[model samples]
Target chain A: MSYCVNCGVELEQSLGQCPLCNTPVINPREAVCNKSPFPEEKGQVEVVKRKDMSILLTTVMVSTSIVCGLLNVLVYSSRPWSLAVIGACILLWVILIPIAIYTRLSVYTSVLLDGLGTVIYLYMLTFLSESSQWFWGIGMPIAVLVTLVTEFLVVCFQMLPRSFLTNTLYSFTSLAALNIGMEILIDRYLQGTVQLGWSTIVLTVCIIVNITIITLLSRKRLRNAVRKRLHF
Target chain B: MAKREKPIPRKDWYQLDLSAIVYPTLHRHDFAPVYRQSVLLTEVVDPELLQRAVDLTMPRFPTYKVAMRKGLFWRYLEPNDRPGPFVQPDIKNPCQPMYFKGNNRYLIRFYYYRNRISLEAHHSLGDGTGCMCVLQTVTAVYLRLKGYPVETAFSKEQGYFVMNIDKQPDPEELEDAYMKYANAKFCPPRPGEKTYRIRGTKESFYTLNIIDGIMSTSAVLAVAKGYHATITEYLNAVLLYALLKKQESDRRLRLKPVKVAMPVNLRRFFPSKTLRNFITMIYPGVDPRLGEYTFEEIVTQVHNDMRYHINEKFLRGDITTNAATKRHPLIRIVTLFIKDFVIKLFYTRVQDHNSSAGLTNMGALKVPESMKPYIVRFDIYMGQPFSSRTNCAIISYEDTLTINFASSIIEADVERYFFRKLVQDGIHVKIESNREMTLEV
Candidate 1:
């Protein structure tokens, strides 16, 4: 018999490491046997593969798009409504391809892929509609702005130290900023002027909420009171 | 000469009891509402004989052979024709959701490894007491099949009392005792305080670490007697005390209530032999926000609470409140899908927040005297805790009381602290784990 150097508990000859501390037994006389007291097969669980799930999802999406495209062309035979189905297929591919292929892709890479996919899918829709002018003027700017704001918020959430109140504050502030940017883009595109309308009211309320949260966080008594009231 | 064989009759389906309704609805992929009970024998298990025993014993447990099906108003249990899953050498974790769609399988499974014969049953079929009855009967049948001179006279029934296998199964065994006994009065729900939950890095691959601490029943009984407490009360105090010590090291958890949900066997209080989940939970512990409490104080509080609340009247009132809610006209009219959604929401939002850990003591296991020589001991392992990281169960057979701690987390601090406390109090504990750690290193 050997003993764990760290925990000082007796170790069985079959166990190479201490069951409690994982300290390797150093005794040369007692050779560790590979067999375990419990069956080896029982220790493992059959975890469902994410890749398999992704493949199944891809199959379903492709099959639906194909069937719809075929029905549109064969049954109607007037307009190329199949193009709309094809555009949807492109969007689905863009959203699901990265998730399916690269399971361990970084968060930043995933967000960037998603943004690129959205832009490409919108471009496909514009090309099919023969509305490149509107796409360049309206759709591209909105999609770019939305993607940038989303990526920024995702980065903030991933990198920043987070608590319930702080997370809520950050999300509200980001949402308010995104709303303001979207309104400015929409106003400039629609009327050739950059003026805010309902966004200012939302922004003001968001600012007040953030300020209240900041105050509560800074004051220990107020923070405890809020926590108690919210039951967080 | 030609002989004619009798055609076997089809079995009829039965409706799920009121207490069993929540189990099927709340069961999810990660959390399967199943529990396991095992009996250790002196000799290694024979797979073929065990299968034969299961085949013979399945008919005896009529309620247990049913499969769950969704009806318009509620989920019901249908009698399944397919045989129970073969007594395989256990190759997967215990109680890992035996129920699946399109499998034509029953809710219970039998597995044997070396000297251990384990039965994992979905809680929807029956409670621990009911499962124990099936296990004891199966063991008796297996011993008899093995040509051991075992008496086949004891009747195998649903309830824990009366181990006689000669009598026919009583129809009362399948009765919804909760509905039958509950007085139709809606009592207001009691408010519950949140308890401190043990947090740790969950074990990879969703594996549970089960550590069985086998000790002498006399030693534990002596300690409990000294404190003027019952075994359950003493064990609850020790578990709480362990949690308290762990909580002290973490400043954030120091003020939380260290409550343990004790499952009270309703059969002891009510005169019912039904095998369904006839149990209620009683949360007993110390509120750490009040102040630091000694071990003695904790025991006294637990003992007092148990003595006061474990009576027939109190349990009847608790069941009545539950039954009244289920029997409410509006609730009964609601479709099963909506009811399932509400139950799932209630389970997570309300019930999960109330208790930190659960302790279920199946108490002592009994077997026919003739079959006792082949059996070494028995163990009861509650599946991983619903919301907490750890749960404990205890069952004593003969002189040995085995305390099984099943945890989803990697840290064994609570078990270590608990067993060490027992050791300090002059009780010897022999530890046996599933040995998952050996593979890790």
Candidate 2:
């Protein structure tokens, strides 16, 4: 006989609270007594375990790296050519292990680990040849810059309220910065003088796109029109 | 020596009806086209008696006692050689995704929670009317097992809904009536626009929140009679209004069409007796962008819309198009791989794009008079829509018309507005839910 005071709809005697508004149902004349509509036991779909996939991946990568290392030492004793294959296996393992094994691994940690793995692989490649200067000057700086820019973009996407315009603005701005940073590092390594040629064109186009996006963000009607047209 | 019993003759396999061809192709791990129909009894259900009832009723439904198998050209239903699915304790989550490979290949699952006996069947098996037959029979058998003098017969004069378990399976019951009644000469094109969708925070994939608003059928029917509309039309108007109000609360212009898909039972219009998904959806909607409408105006629009679309000629044209497409040389010659890809693409992109929400009124269920004294009420609950946030189903037994809302989101605004609107219309509603809400002092 109890009714929700807020919704004004009578509730089942079995219900202690109103389902619509979550209001307490208390009738001083009647004691609340009846079984619920559903049972106490709840069932849920079983999530497929990723641990088996992680074990399989580890076995494959480890065996491939071992086979390549043994071939370089025993069969092809002339040079250590297997370093490249082993480095590739190591890089892939580092990137996929986090995704397959852990659910709570943050995007920031994954991107940083990928950067470190790439740097190590490049360093390993330098061992096959006598040119360590290219790896230090070009490979190290570019990989680190790409990873840092990606991490910054991920942070921006997470921290800010996301819409089509906001996400595009973040992307174009980061693209320009990454392009400029890469050119500077490449210029320093190749010619020892800072000269911007192709990056300026990219920077100009990015600036124009970013300005257009900013304009669209500021005007609701225009943003809605573009959304309707683009069907995003 | 023990006396030997006579073996019942049945078909080993059945073809997927015209309407059923798309459901299996559109099935996903997160989505399955499943709906539930349950009966509430006066006493707590005994699991042993319920299991015996299920075991007795499973063999009577030839079209339902089968499992899905992939054929070279199409997927077909073959009789499951294993035993019937065992009855299980009902869970808070009623209709989860169903897979055919497991659980003895049973397409239908039975659950008992206290006085409620629920039957969750895949849409591919049959429509609500078809499954209702199985549910009513199971309930009647359970009552008989519990020492009630419940009589069962499948006389067409009385009605085709009630089943006789001892009789042999009929070939006409297993026939695909869609192919039988499809007239290719009257094929009509059904073009649709992308309709507005209710946006909300997504809950976990496994969670389905069910809220039931139990009300008196006479009270609601009297109100509908006042409006010069049928119960389905009146309820649809109320649902659309509730959705419109929810959309307007966002303080945005209500430009998108607020439409609810109403599933019409083909048996009412045609003479077909088979129960293999003979239903079509009619979208009765209001174009809020056109202008503001009063509640009376919306009712008139929905009433006229439903009256205009629900006819034998129009529905025949619609089913004709589907049947023609299925029988086309290009469609039939292709292997199932290509057919499945096309069907999946069409279903995901175009099928549910025309409706804001869905409302299915199974219309007052008629229980046999002998078993009426022991039954409390009947309920029909639709599973979550693939695109819409919530969908509703209605069924009534005796004087109680239970409106069940199945939602995938965490919000209760839609259900609140809907019931409050009914209460405002002078209909008394009693609310209950599978979810237990907290009470603040």
Candidate 3:
């Protein structure tokens, strides 16, 4: 940190002139050597880092499906279940993978992908098994709910405030609202064992308690600590 | 010499256009037109005393008051509504506001009712000092009629400010305003004693919402005196301090000097009172940027600084542009075009934040206690301050003063703030809103 020659104000960025005093910055060679050897990097401009995660996306899904298919073949040798499972995996990849990875993609794309996956999985189950009562009555709703819940939680977590407490409160509040609405929709729109079970009750209880604690913590005076970002 | 089809010469168009560019609520508030808020010494005006004053004044003036009815030679200010290209269809009519293109072609208005009187004049003709003289003369005459012994001791103070000039008043503008039954057309008659001109009331722009809590001029003076400051200095210093509390900048704030336009009566300067428009203006600006000084220190500066300028700096002949030497035909043509747009624009912006609002001391009004008890109350008329937009006018009638601020879209807080600050400074104030408007003057 160099001080301005004219006004003695601190200089932030090293491109030379100070913002407050408009004084040029100079790196005196001897002064630089006298400073600490390692310090937190200062005056760095932020840039977005693009992760090369796409190339590995399809490969991982295909390999996971193949392993499950091979396992199915070994478990049931005389049945066509193994072939069916493999077909299901290939269809899921074809329909869902692209939807999952659309960069600069919006929330609607994510929801659409979850919808497609639910339809395909449920269709396969219905066609493949006639006597499986659990899959027909309870299993289909659970599958769709799980997929939607996971996607929504992911989206909420990403969009929440950077502070830990605010983020937690936001996630809980959003999830609670989403779940209650979804429960109403499920009961009215779907039939048979439509009521929410014990797991749903447990999740709701946890969210409510956590949200209360967060709300209490978010009082006025304490919020001052969260205002450091507004200087600009 | 029965000529027809005369051209109405285009002139001073810019200064005239200033009213158009800056609306009354916004721009008019910036500059303080010279205000000498005085009281009519109405109780005692002995004729012998006034006659003595007139005798002394006449040798210098030659033609004291011009007659319109008494002389039947000059009469246009009563009302004019001809559709000239520049003359606006005089809105807020009966055109009580003086209308003057230059010398001779102008109006002098005096509004009166019972014992109260107000004098409003157009600037192109003369300055405030001249108007004040006219007001003083009118007051003296009224007191005599009401039966009072006002000694006519001739003091230079009374006639010390009138202006002397040799140029004749301009010829009548239109053949239609007055049909020349064969006189070529008389010069607009100068105000002589026989034919006195009159106008309606000059109302205070806005009704000041004064919360009168029993503070007086003496109370404020005492507080300021405690700080080794006079009334104005103490008020100005305290005002500056309050302004400092609202902002975050550590750097000292510097407001452009608050400018008050002082109209110098030219009668004393040259030695003539022909009543043919001879007045000039002076802009007195007070600097408020002394940066974190103690209240006492700031007050001392304001007191000493203002007292000095009130005499020497005022009427130094540099305030208003001198139209004498530059009254060439070519210059008038250029000025006519330029001033048509420029002067009005200049008044609009300059009058606001640069000068802010005005504080005019019309001085103590004198009257005998027996006949009329005492001078009851008086209000000084000026442009009002605009909120978030314009300026205000402050006129002091001795112990009481009116703060008039205006807004196109009025808000309650701005007025509240003005009074709040005044009360905080230990000033006794009262407010009168649109309840009592001045008729016209």
The TM-scores that each candidate's chain B achieves against the reference are: 0.93, 0.96, 0.50
Number of the top-ranking candidate, with TM-score as the measure? 1
Which is superior by TM-score, 1 or 2?
A: 1
| Candidate 3: true interface contacts recovered | 0.00
Q: Estimate, for each residue in A26-82, the C-alpha lDDT of model 2 and write its tens digit.
A: 799987777677777777753546788899988999999999899989899787788
lDDT score, candidate 2, position B201? 68
Question: Tens digits of per-residue lDDT for model 1 on B29-128?
Answer: 6777878988899999999999998887776677888878888999888877785656878754676754445235567878898998998888888888
**Candidate order, DockQ descending:** 2, 1, 3
Q: Tens digit of lDDT per residue, candidate 3, span B400-427? A: 5444433222223333443455555555
B1-441: candidate 2 lDDT, tens digit per residue:
123346667677889998788888877788788899989989999999999998988887888889999999999999886876789988888788887765677788999988999999989999999999989999988898899988886486687467888776666778899888888587788858777778876767777888999999999999999999988889999999988888787576546888888898988888877867899888999988888989899999999998889999888888898898888998898999999999888877877778888899999888888998988998888896786478999988789999999988777778888999999999999887877565543
TM-score of 3: 0.37
Comparing 1 and 3 by DockQ, which wins?
Answer: 1
CAPRI quality band, candidate 3: incorrect
Q: How far does residue A43 in candidate 1 sit from its true spot (Å)?
A: 2.9
TM-score ranking, best first? 1, 2, 3
Cα error, candidate 3, residue B104 (Å): 15
